[model samples]
Target: MATDPVCKMNVEPAKAAAKVDYNGQLYYFCSESCHKAFTEAPQKYAGAAPPPHSSHQHGHR
Candidate 1:
């Protein structure tokens, strides 16, 4: 699973229908709105480092 950068929601990497590539990193989103928001200014949202243990245990940004 991966965290949706726009809303900090849990997104299954294999199931996400919305995703964007920013600076060579992949960001998954829960909805089109979230995806568009990130698309507008990817650098602003793309730089966000997930919370501690986010790669496993999820948390807010």
Candidate 2:
């Protein structure tokens, strides 16, 4: 399972809605919206460390 960098949803690479190769790493997305968002600003999500638990909620809101 791979985490969709845009939405943080778990996705099976084989069943991913879209996938992209960036900086030698592969990223999977659950939907085209996510894929488009990532493509537009990969540096915003790519290689970005997951937020700490305490601040995680802030992102969702």
Give the per-residue lDDT of model 1 (tens digit) for 1-61.
8999888899998888698777667889888998999999887787677445555644445
Most lDDT-accurate candidate = 2
Residue-wise C-alpha lDDT for candidate 2, range 1-61, written one tens digit per residue: 9999999999999999999999878999999999999999999998585435647667776
lDDT of 2: 0.90
> What's the CA error at residue 31 for candidate 1, in Å?
0.5
